[model samples]
Target: MTCSEPARTTTGRLPGGLVTTTRRIRRTLAAGPRVVIAAVVKALGYRLVRVQYHGTLGEADGAVPRGTTVFDDEVPAVANLDPALLGALREAAKDAANDGVEFFVNSGWRSPEYQNRLRREAVSRYGSEKEAARWVATPGTSPHVSGNAVDIGPSEAKAWLSEHGARYGLCQIYRNEPWHYELRPEAVEHGCPPMYPDPSHDPRMRQ
Candidate 1:
């Protein structure tokens, strides 16, 4: 439905949908038609946020931040993180290593092609698009493809980071993803923001 569609809308609700749009997000979405409607709402909104590629994924050559660098003999390979975010992650990882926990970079700086592949793989594994979207993000708006996110791994590393990451301005953005961390500089001063309950409700997914 277009924004002008008439079915009556309260603040935050989609113009013609019954699934209430919300600011407080959950990390996992239940599989159902209402959730499917929420996915469509987010999908449409994402298209509008892409000022450059017009919602095309994996073609963001212009999205690369200036001065971005690749890994240099690090304990684990992680490339294409935002320059400042990489610095913060290294510092945080160094500290975590002191506690006998090393953060392994499972993914970093994914291309649109790569991200889309992940989405496809997820859809196959989960058996449906709506269920897959609750986990893997569509490429165009994924922070990872834009070099803004890194997934850390190893249960021990995730455990250590969960407890101490905020001190270094690192934060886990999703409630269900314990190993995903992003550089949230404000966390150093105010601490990490609360995790989104799930991607379906996360306002960021729409952007």
Candidate 2:
């Protein structure tokens, strides 16, 4: 899932834990440049805030390490995907690799709890449920939670998929997120369906 941009307003107080963490970080960085210290503190605050917002996730929920490939059976993110869809992705990845392209799984199957956390974070970032709906789907409506969707990464990989994915039944599902893909077995013959502008425009999300 995409991380929300750091909140724009600077008026709110930091959480007590975050405040204490910041002081500790500042002391640890006493000899660092002013700019570097400030940046580090900000980054730490963002991470702690996310920890508070999303709790914690582990392998069972499909969290995977960086560079996880479609063929990695040991990774829950790759293993828990719908079998047919996973097969298509593996076939596509194998072909893509011949051309020096690698498919890295940025996200795959997610638990409902993780999906809900993401939706709530999106709402906090965008300031309303209406706006957040354009990006994050509700837990019950998210394809990721149902093992039917995958978000791939590395610009070259996404570009390669855009050009050749449909041949393997993998198709981009949203106009705004080229990284997001789903399996459409019919796409191998007739080509993929039209793209939704965003999650908000998808009929499946209304359910």
Q: What is the TM-score of each candidate against the true structure?
A: 0.63, 0.73
Candidate 1: regions farther than 4 A off? 1-77
Per-residue alpha-carbon lDDT of model 1 for 77-106, expressed as tens digits? 244568888888888777776887676666
- Ten-residue region with minimum lDDT total, candidate 2: 45-54
The count of residue-pair clashes in candidate 1 stands at 6
